[model samples]
Target: EAEVAQSPRYKITEKSQAVAFWCDPISGHATLYWYRQILGQGPELLVQFQDESVVDDSQLPKDRFSAERLKGVDSTLKIQPAELGDSAMYLCASAGALNTEAFFGQGTRLTVV
Candidate 1:
């Protein structure tokens, strides 16, 4: 029973600075997703990838946020010039395929002041 790996469980950054989170899903999972969860709210999808190709990222702020899975294994989510509204938990999840049971990471909590 492997698990998803996330780095820097907590982060604090001044507004307008750059921050990034990394995730490595369980081996052999083909679908990876990035999500943002505000306090008291459920996670919201930020990006989805299938084998190195982006499947969806409509909810992602293109100007400030970006996500990528170079080899379809590990992924990164980055925010440049972070804002106060960007403070939240960044979560990474993976599933064997779409609509399957997904496994989640511990999540990276970001705070922007």
Candidate 2:
């Protein structure tokens, strides 16, 4: 199976604290995405990048969340002054130029107290 690498699989942070998660997609994939999943719910798209440019981020909370794929290979997602509602699984996914069948990482489990 193809792999997308994510770091710090688990994170515990206090409310109003900042947190960051990282992902490295498959070597040649050019499309990447960041998603947030609440328990018992489907993953929700937070951001999408085609190469280094953002394709979509309408669902992202601009007031506190940000994501980037600087060189179009690896990406980072950050949340500042996180709130209790921010607790969820952050997942990273990648797809080829065709943009079909994305491969996903194990995801980072975040708990904001």
Q: Which candidate tops TM-score?
A: 1
- Predicted candidate 1 versus true structure: per-residue lDDT over 10-32, tens digit per residue: 99999999999999999999999
TM-score of each: 0.97, 0.97
Q: Give RMSD (Å) of candidate 1 vs. truth.
A: 0.7
Runs off by more than 4 Å, candidate 1: none
Poorest lDDT segment (10 consecutive residues) of candidate 2: 94-103
Which RMSD values do the candidates have, in order?
A: 0.7, 0.9
Which candidate ranks first by lDDT, i.e. highest? 1
lDDT digits (tens) for residues 34-69 of candidate 2:
999999999999999999999999999999999988
Q: Which ten residues in a row have the lowest lDDT in candidate 1?
A: 93-102
lDDT against the true structure, each candidate = 0.96, 0.95
